[model samples]
Target chain A: MKSKITRIIILLSYSFVNLYLIVTKKILKYVHPKIIPIIVISIIIMSIASMILILNIKIENHNKSKKNMYIIFIIPIAMILFIPFKQSECLNTNFTVTQNISIDNKEFESAGKQSISNNDVMNSKEIDINEVIENNKLDEKIKELILENDVIVVTDNNFVKWMDELYENKIYENKEIQITGFAYKESNFSKSEFVIARYIMVCCAAHMAVGGLMCNYMADDIQQDSWYNISGTIKYETYDGETLPIIKVNKAVETETPSVEYVYPY
Target chain B: MYKNKAKNTTLHNLTLIIITLSFGYLLGHLIVYIGFDQVSRTVKIFSTKFTSIIIEALPFLLIGSFISSLLHVFVPIDTLVKIFPENKFTGTLFAVVAGVFVPLCDCAIIPIAMRLIKKEVPVHIAITFMLAAPIVNPISIMSTLFAFSGKTNIAIIRVLFGIIISISVGFLFSLLVKNKEIINDKNYCSHCTINLNNTVWDKINELFLHTSEEFFNIGKYVITGIFISTIFQMMFDSIGLNNISISNNHALLLMLLFAFCISACSNSDAFIARGLMNSFPFGSIIGFLVFGPMLDLKNILVLNKYFKRHVLIIFTITLVLLTYTIVSIAFF
Candidate 1:
């Protein structure tokens, strides 16, 4: 009788974790939409099984020692209940602040140089702006950005790719780009320079990486880790003896943070 | 005498209720304090990463357990034995292809594989299924392809490499393992697989019973694995592994270790691999793609419940050497 109760409690807890993920809407933060069906199906199957097992609790008692292992399963329950969708205070706190500010200029230069040399053969010729336009399967927002006469909105989805292309091909050097993101500055950055960035998420929040573009604007108004909208023309600037594209900001406005903190990859 | 016995039982129940309520009250207070007030940075970071991993992985683990239960209840031993080829080469080869057919996650494949082994399926073939299914599954391959931005070559290479390592390891284990009993407990099979030839309702009940059994049995190790790997990832990230300049071989070694330590699900591991693409060499990334799903901090603990010490050692060594050799030859 004791074992039966333990088994029911354990099985329900397993079911509850999946059900909790669905209820709290925290499931979206973890997996892609394509995998949702499988997740739902699994939850239903497990829940049904748990209910069936409870009805017919004729399980032969196994090793008594194994009962101790069941205690560990409660960790997920505790985590889900206590910390569901809560932001970590340490995320943008002092330690991260210090780490973000203490950047190595030489390392950036080397990284920039390494990328140029490594992909020189692959992208030797200039990239055709028409080629990107010709790709019909591209996101409509990106297509709209391309179709705009001179100004382009660098959204969270297209920010990383746009920056990579602008860095490599240098075709959009003179076009005015409008981008909005939080301000991030490295130690090596000058007072007038910072990055407009968002965390790029390819799979889940756990695998997110920082993706942003360099901006040269007045730093007095923009605070670290605060959101802002900046309109700027693209230009190659020599910083710390390395030449890379930077947005020469024409206007800056403080803005509220976006609902979605992380940017999904396009 | 009867009145005294009833009074004793009533006292026991009351004590249990009182203790539970007090514990709940304390726990609620503690959580409220932590949520509102400040805590150490390490504690916050650990909680965030730990929750993220468990949340992301629970679905896969559920799917795995569900499949394992289905296999335990429905899949007959004769059906498997008959389908298994007589030739050892074909048998191992079939194991590799069989993974593609089942298309389950790493966490789910172990219970099914263990069941097969208990059913007297060739131990090495079952091992092959265990290693290859996580990597070679259609869902994983599709996700890998998508993650690499439609790079079919990388996806194909990962699948091919997974097959090669899985086959070699399977064959090696077949030669090395003398005993057929892989599980530690001998009586585990008797209760789990019994009542198979019963009425339909009884069979259905047994299915759920066995699934619940299999899930709870393997679920603890997974939680332990996740806790350890989360700490490992946090330390590696905070320490800034990318800051160090590493040689190609050195990077490969580091990446392989990272793959083992992080133990990200195979479906999403490609995204993690792609994230590391610009910083690390292609070979090291490929090494990570191949090595991670086959073995990681969590699955290793899960595997320990089944395989012997020497078998695991052989499995690990053979996979590492073969994967390194193949990746080195291809890229370097």
Candidate 2:
């Protein structure tokens, strides 16, 4: 008689959990995009199985071991019930590029021209001469020397989007943008076009999504997956029903690869 | 002799019932105190923490579980025994390879491997299969590929490392724990015996029973692991660990601690690893995947139930060392 009551309680508990999961999944759909389908399916399957198990208990002959099975089932549900004890708000900080620049508006306009006007300023600091030439401000021969020595090239879809956004916002329009990412080129495509790519992960690398920015350059000049820091102007184009953005290369240079190549800014 | 045996059996049965009743009461009390509102909140938190893990791992778990059930229901024990070399050295090799093909996850594999061990499958082979099957199966392989975005090299490295570790550990275990007396002597067909006279129905019953049992066993582990991990996640959120500089490789350290505490199943660890990647490293993430399936809090409890203390100690040490080595080499 004691065992019969225990069995009924176990069955009811299991049924409640199964019903709870189904309802919870429905509630979660508004909060998280990916989990709704998985939750609904899991609840349905678990509920059906629990119902079958409960019905089986009713017909099966009295067995002492059935109690043990109920114990196993309850432990997990009990553990799950402990989740609210630790629930708290997640901290979210938005680090924007506009926040990084400390320079006043007066200093910004003069800094670029002053650096360009003085020969001492030009010679003392590392400046890409090719950029001056590309902007039609310097000689082509000086630009060639600059292109031959120092410039980093990035070619990946995500990097391209990042660069496009950075350019559209005028964050690095007249200034230098230093980027480190992988180099990729599609075969049978244009020889002058390549991409710098990096994988963006949300939680673990398992859900890592690839992002890169496109760069127009000779394929022979850049190796795949090579790290680079290119200083260039960002440009935009439209292709295949999407607006495309890219960096117009003034100079390209190779650099030592970082030990950890992937970086998720978010 | 029959009377004495019956008396001992009755005593054991009574003890088991008492344990179950006490555990059930504790569980009922926990549910009631937490109340329906809190219960729903906990479930929501747990489901969120584990949703990604389950999504990433479910396909592999299903495939691996199905394959394992198929092997159990269809393959003859003698046929499996014949495939391996009789010598321990070569037998361990066959064991590791067999582990890769078997679909059983960490917890469910224990019973199936024990069954194989009783049927004259070499102890080393069974041990290797038991250790490696959860980490090296086709479903795990597919999930890893999809998780890493077809990074074939990393997937290959994981499989190779798993094989090497499982084989070596299996061989070591066979030498250390040679006593047959330590193994469970219960009938493999205890649950299936009721419908045995009808072969077709019996086979169907066995398959259904085995699958259901396997699902419940592993599912419980997953649910528990997810709950603990969620708590940890909440703690991390409260402390503002998410905003910390993960780029410095400290994310791996945090995830290792999290994996140890949560003790998630290997098949589902990838999803947890995925969510963690935003804060951890590829190497430390792999460590969680390799180690959690082999040695976790829940599996440890299950292990303690069957294996002697001394054997469990050796197994735990070897598994931890191998996991550390494999993950270090891959990430460092």
Candidate 3:
């Protein structure tokens, strides 16, 4: 009689889980916000069911193994209880303040540079190194100002517009600046112009977008894939309906390529 | 005899339950106190973003379990013995291919695979199916489409590559581990050995009881996975790791680590991938989504239970390589 009752309980619970699975998927699509509570309830029910099932099964001659599995099962539940709830706190905090600050100004900026050792500024900051170099000449005063302020808000959608505005305003003309990034020689190999590029990642490196700045250098001196710190003044050019910022080379020197090259811009 | 059998089965089950609950509680406490808030937060974010993953996946789990139970209940061992090809090589090939069509996730597939083992299926075939079905199923493909937002080519590439790797690795391992002595024989508990002589109501009651026991056993892990993932997500957002600038390649590394920490299901990993698109390189992002569901922190615990340690290790290494190669080629 006990066995029969156990069997019936199992089957009904199994059926309910299956039904919930099917219904929830559809419900989540039409009304996405309700997914959280539904998921929480589903998880709770599933956990209870799992505990009961684990209790009923017996592995002959494997007491230790069964014990270990039990440990694995309970650990996450305990974590759930002890871990302080922080989701609400996180939602309340403004992520934008950090985003607006340039990578060079983040609280962990110095520590990050120290840990990595290679001072690839392009990979470290929110401002495009190329864009910054082109739009604002790195006069000692300007460089010092940037170092002090230490935040650049660069987004893929706003990059071109920002660059155009910087050029029109002559924000970086004849001011010596330093920019570091990967060197991508334009395929056309124009004698006096080439593109320097860096990857911009938004979430994790999986969905990376590329950002680049045009710089004019003597054909013989440019090397593809070379990492460089170019000190230059900003110049503007128009090509095929797009405005391009040209880093008028004051000085160009190659630097060691950092061991890690692609940087995501959050 | 019946009374003795019932007593032994009951004792075994009760012991198993006690062990599982104790372990679950211990691990949960350790994670919370250990100060790996980064991991905790990633898990939480993943759970919140992909709540539908468990829901979408539960149906497949139930179906797989039902089929396994049915096979256990009705199929005779002698009849099952003749179902495979006479030639080992041909049998393995058939098994690997068939495994691709089944589409069971790692957690649920174990029960089905164990059933097959009992039904006299070659261990090689069972292993192959266990690995292949989770990533190569119709739902996985459809979910990938939703994650990538109509990148049919990426989805196709992932599925094709997934199958090739699983089959090849499964076959190689079959050759390396030829000892069939480890396989368990099919022996139902006295409770499971229902007498047809009983009334219809009795049979129904028996089935329900058996199903609930199995459901509860597995359901705990699912819930744990969801809760851990939810907490991790919250922490990740709070810390603002998403905004850090590291090179595209390094960003991929972080993403892979993050995915492992969160342990999202394969079906929902793509949605997480989509959310992260702006933060990392395309290749690295692909690696995070692909490699994670196959061999992350949580899935590894589940896989460790069924597969030999060496087999699991080899599987993890191969999956990482395959995911990296595919992503590199696609993005480059």
lDDT of 2 by residue, B1-332 (tens): 57645754674475466555544643564577578754454344434444434433333333334445656776765777888898877777777777676655575566667657655687778888887887887767765544433234445656776777777777777777774744533312335333334587556545544554545434444444444444454444335333455542455555556666665555445544443443345566666666666666546645554565577788888777666665666566
Q: What TM-score fits each model?
A: 0.81, 0.51, 0.49
C-alpha lDDT (0 to 100) for residue B194 of candidate 2: 38
Docking class of 1: acceptable
True contacts kept of each: 0.31, 0.01, 0.01
Candidate 3, after superposition: displacement of residue A56 in Å?
Answer: 12
Best by DockQ: 1
Evaluated on CA atoms against the true complex, candidate 3 attains a DockQ of 0.04
lDDT of each: 0.67, 0.49, 0.49
Q: What is the lDDT of residue B57 in candidate 3?
A: 39
Q: Model 3: which docking level applies? A: incorrect
Which residue pairs in candidate 1 have backbone atoms (N, alpha carbon, C) closer than 3 angstroms, thus clashing? A101-A187, B64-B108
- Winner by TM-score: 1
Chain A TM-score, structure 2: 0.37
- What tens digits encode model 1's per-residue C-alpha lDDT throughout B81-169? 87899799899889888899877668778877877887778877888999999999898897776554424567877898888888887
Better of 2 and 3 by DockQ: 2
Tell me the lDDT of model 3 at A232: 69
What is the per-residue lDDT of model 3 for residues B109-209, given as tens digits with 9 covering 90 to 100? 76677667656677667766766676777756766764443235456656665666566666666666653543311223224444547765545444434
